[model samples]
Target: MNVCGLDRWLRILVGIILVGLAAAGAIGVWGWIGLIPLLTGLFRWCPLYAIFGFQTCGLAEQKYGS
Candidate 1:
């Protein structure tokens, strides 16, 4: 299913965070909450991956063997 170098879901999550943080001044805590997703996306470390059993990064998976 996933063949990219980064998890698809994570990408979306990070995108959401980025948007929220960018709108932080208006959205309140939602904006601040955006950091978690932003960081996870930048680092490509999504906690949801374990629970969802999904990985989108083939390059890293091959290298790390996970």
Candidate 2:
């Protein structure tokens, strides 16, 4: 998994807040975009991280090697 720890948590939090706001009609349809982060955080795999060769999960480093 490319996402983990604080980064992952933050994504989940932001996603929840955005989606929640959208649901409450506080923001708008744009809040729906929060789903991207929500799914990425939930899945623990980020496509952008893969493309950019970035990894925050230390477990991934040890398991997969540098």
Candidate 3:
């Protein structure tokens, strides 16, 4: 939830592209790693962000348990 809308969307898009490429055999198995970003984006929780004490969620959202 700490992820901003745009950032989350971008991660989702990139993850989908990478995973799709992997599934299509267009890329190496490494592309499957895209799941990381995909899950993070969908969950709106980033470990790195937490470590860095960063948050992109709106004030209201954050206050409401984002």
Question: Pick by lDDT: which candidate is best?
Answer: 2
lDDT of 3 by residue, 1-66 (tens): 678678888889999999999999999999999998898899999999999999778888777854
State the lDDT of candidate 1 residue by residue for 1-66, as single tens digits.
222354545665766866765675655655666666556656666677756876567766657744
Candidate 2 lDDT, 1-66, residue by residue in tens? 898888888999999999999999999999999999999988888999999999788975548733
- State the C-alpha lDDT per candidate: 0.60, 0.89, 0.88
Q: Supply candidate 1's per-residue lDDT for 54.
A: 69
- RMSD (Cα, Å) for all candidates, in order, is 5.1, 3.3, 1.7
Q: Which residue pairs come into collision in candidate 3?
A: 1-44
The alpha-carbon lDDT assigned to residue 13 of candidate 1 equals: 75
How does model 1 fare in lDDT? 0.60
Rank candidates, lDDT, best first: 2, 3, 1
Clashes of each: 1, 0, 1
Q: What is the Cα-based TM-score of model 2?
A: 0.87
User: After best superposition, candidate 2 residue 59: deviation in angstroms?
Assistant: 3.2
- Kindly report which residue stretches of model 2 are placed more than 4 angstroms away from their true locations once superposed: 60-66
Give each model a TM-score.
0.51, 0.87, 0.86
Determine which window of 10 residues in candidate 2 has minimal summed lDDT: 57-66
